[model samples]
Target chain A: MAQVRNKQVLLKNYVIGFPKESDMEIVEGSITLKVPEGSSDVVLLKNLYLSCDPYMRLLMYKDTPVSLGFHYSPGSPLTAFGVSKVVESGDPNYKKDDLVWGVTKWEEYSLVPSAQILFKIDHTDVPLSYYTGILGMPGITAYGGFFELGCPKKGEKVFVSAASGAVGQLVGQFAKLTGCYVVGSAGSQEKVDILKNKLGFDEAFNYKEESNLDAALKRYFPEGIDIYFENVGGKTLDAVLLNMRSHGRIPVCGMISQYNLSQAEGVTNMAYLIYKEIKMQGFIVSQFYPLYPKFLEFILPHIREGKIAYVEDIVEGLESGPAALVGLFSGQNFGKKVLAIAPQ
Target chain B: MAQVRNKQVLLKNYVIGFPKESDMEIVEGSITLKVPEGSSDVVLLKNLYLSCDPYMRLLMYKDTPVSLGFHYSPGSPLTAFGVSKVVESGDPNYKKDDLVWGVTKWEEYSLVPSAQILFKIDHTDVPLSYYTGILGMPGITAYGGFFELGCPKKGEKVFVSAASGAVGQLVGQFAKLTGCYVVGSAGSQEKVDILKNKLGFDEAFNYKEESNLDAALKRYFPEGIDIYFENVGGKTLDAVLLNMRSHGRIPVCGMISQYNLSQAEGVTNMAYLIYKEIKMQGFIVSQFYPLYPKFLEFILPHIREGKIAYVEDIVEGLESGPAALVGLFSGQNFGKKVLAIAPQ
Candidate 1:
């Protein structure tokens, strides 16, 4: 085993509002990569690629009554999806050099006590880095949230917000594959282009440029939106509520626009949800973990046949990790933001 | 049959804000209550017990898209739930002396075609007056919304807003019967007492006196709310969102608090819905009409067995109808506000 060394990122303090760059700091110390001699069940892993997601911004806040996952405590490395290679195994099921995708620290290596949360990656035909995003949590999120929650049908008018982001991009592609009319809204013109020309969305709009989001939706969805995959919640959600068809379904995967705010903006047009009898559900990707194998079965064939496409904004090295993580909140990254720690 | 006369209540014009006494005026004219000569399936009857729901306040505004059911033309009688015996029947299923509950004109009588939206009151052991409130649409709303949408489990904490009102009162009773720890909020102390002492709620509070709604909810629901039957929206909903437990469900039956306002109030704590993975569904009673028979079968036995109790604020005559209906918006009525047109 390598000499015990721990390179960790710690939260300085609980964030009051929006998280600033200074809120998190990376520190270095030492620890053994292998479990101690007395320990019966502990595996050490070298994290290869880490996922930077918008929901992490929420963890910086102090204790709250509501949270889907564990709160990030001050002076602790943030929890996120990572691709790691098992170096030492305490469990009989895992062996050395077994690649896995699961929760890990935002550092070089981690000693995971229980291997229950980890899933062994079996498909080597695709890039291992895909486990950090497109083929991992976000991938299953798009698959389960859209098909299971959104219940998209062929010819339905589907609208996605934060269109070119990790989950939204995949949702648009999946909707298109199902023969639905899909439109998406993104922050930049470049993203709008990627949504339309590359991701195969029927239409795409730059929400930053549109003065009236409701009008933009009406123009794109003349008949009205049958399914809304809610990623950005606030004014965009209010607008989508007004343009939703009767019996429309909204799968609330994430609300990036409202996460960092001390008080989330009020949605004025939510009454439309009642008037149109809309079914809006908020779901965490973790709830569908049991479906991960099924998700892979559905997605892998598409990838091999070249029917599905995925994009990533890879930032190299551990030094650039903080900036890459924070870039997601500012909409600075072009696609799925990933940090590459080591080569396969 | 009596000579056909159409008595109608017309909107004086679009109401600017909250509807007032002067916003609607009643007018009378002659029309045939009998079905037209060549009509294949049309039934005409004397209208009775016009229900005044908060949603009607939205229809008073011009071009607001407020009518979720059907549009009302200028100078037309307002449409709502009413019980009436068929005076003339063109459809095969309906005939004279057969009482029905459905959309009817806000006047002395109405000419309804096909009886498609109407449901016959098969069980008359309960008060026929209940067809307008407890045993009718509001009853089905409370039943279907609580069981199907909210999915309340045994011993779960359930919260109902507008507790003393028509739909809310039943929801509280339904929760109590299901072995839930039910808490309710009302606008007045008297209503609160009825909720606790008379209606058998585990806890009840007058929201008007509570300085902090979130604190009030926390005090009443120490373990947090498992089901929130949302009838009154705005700040009440905001407070409920903050106190909801993980996997909480909110059935958006009505937003009585925001119905009369020209612009709806924004709920500030909506992000809690996402953080808690709450399932908030907005549904219409009309959508659950098909389940009414099953609902009555479930509820009537409860009523007969004395497991459920209800309260109604009855207005004696048609002249007091407008005020009785509008009383719901102001939280002036002690319980289900019903205008008694005729005794069964």
Candidate 2:
């Protein structure tokens, strides 16, 4: 076994409010480039791309009840989903130099338990960094939340909030594939333009510029929304509630807007659920992972044929990780934010 | 044709804010004793009993976007579901003196269209007024909202707001019948007693007495609520959001507390839906009407066997109707409120 320098991002302390760059410290440490002897279920990996997801903000809070089966502690490297290449393996499923994507730490080299690896990377024709985004968690999130929970019918009206982000962009495209009239709301005019001109959304509006979200939603969905993929909660959810048609479906994927708030905003229009016979359901993408093979089979062709497009906002080095992660809460990331550490 | 005096409850004007008894006026109108000569689809009915349900308050609002298929106009009679005697009928479904329950006016005599009649009273073993409460619309509302939407499994923890009200009482009973641990909340100590001691609820609490609804819910459902049958929304609903178990289901029937408010209270705990992967659905009982016969088959036996019981707060005459209807908003009614006009 040999020691190598492992540059890591570690949580300095528990975050109380909006996180700043100072909350996380980039530390250089050494690690043996091998799994511990007799640890048959451990594999050593060189972390490639680390995904900066809105869900990571939740982990920074002290004793946050909600967890995605992972927890972060002060003085330890923060763990997240990433694309990595195996440096050594004690498990037969993976070998040295094998590419994979799964839950890994925000460091140069990680000794991950074999069970923590989500999948062996089989397709590499496209950008391997995609494993941290469009080809990974966010992709499955859009598929499960939209198709499974949303159940959009042809010609139905669809609305997506935070539509330029990792999950929302794909959801809009999927809605269009179902022949729905899709409209999306993003914080910036640039993101709104990408939703309309690039993603093929029928209409896109900058939510930040809209004084009255309800009126804006009403204008976009004159006939009322049949499906709403709720990403940014709070005011956006309240507005969408009023615009939902009879038997409308709302699949709540993420509420990034509410995540960092001291006190989450109140939604006053929830009574609309009964008036319109609406179904508002919330789900985690991991619950639908069994469908990943089929998801890949479904989305791969669209990607190759140019029917579907994905965007990633990549930042280099592990040291840039904290800022990239923090930027997600402020709508600073243009698309999927990925920290490229050891890019393949 | 002979003309008869018809005493009716007429709306003085469309209501604003909390409805007051003064908003309705008692008027003596006249109706023909017989169905119109060539009006084959018409049926003249002598009104028997009128049900005072929470949903009726929604119709009192001026130009409410949602309605139960009928409206109340100023100086005209208010319409509601009532049991009546078919004095004269041109439709073959009924003959003179046939007993029925359906949408009828708040009056001594009502000339109703045949299509508006809901059902011909078949089982005479139960009280005819039961047609207005346990055996009629509210019956189906509780059945549909709880069994269909709540989807309680054995040993699941269930919570019902408006516990001793028409629908909530029945929902608690149904949850208990399904082998679930059921808790209920009401406005007064008496209603809470009726819930735990008489209705077979595992525990009951007076919501009005509980300063911290979240703490109250935690005390009763320490393991967390698996199903919440939402009747009284607002604060109770907000609190329930924090105490829900993963994959919890909230079936929205009516938000009585919210309907009267100029500005409905905001629910700030909606983010829990995503964290817990909960399903909060709103529905009208009409969607479950097709399952009515099966519902009757399931409940009637329990009622006959003394395994299930229903309580009603009855007031005499159409004159007491306005007061009784207004009382529901204040939690003045003990159980299901019914106005007995002409008893069978």
Best by TM-score: 2
DockQ per candidate, 2 decimals: 0.66, 0.81
Model 1: per-residue Cα lDDT over A238-263, one tens digit each: 89999999889999988888877777
Query: For this target, which candidate reaches the highest DockQ against the unseen true structure?
Result: 2
Which sections of candidate 2 miss by over 4 Å?
none
* Leading candidate by lDDT: 2
- Sorted into a CAPRI-style docking class, model 2 comes out as high
- lDDT per residue for candidate 2 within A295-336, as digits (tens), equals 999998898899999988999999899999889888999989
Where is model 1 chain B poorest over a 10-residue stretch in terms of lDDT?
Answer: B64-73
What residue pairs clash in candidate 1, if any at all? A4-A31, A4-A32, A5-A31, B47-B109
> Could you tell me how far off, in angstroms, the CA of residue B104 lies in candidate 1 after the best superposition?
1.2
**Model 1 ranges with Cα > 4 A deviation:** A1-5, A64-69, B1-7, B30-33, B64-68
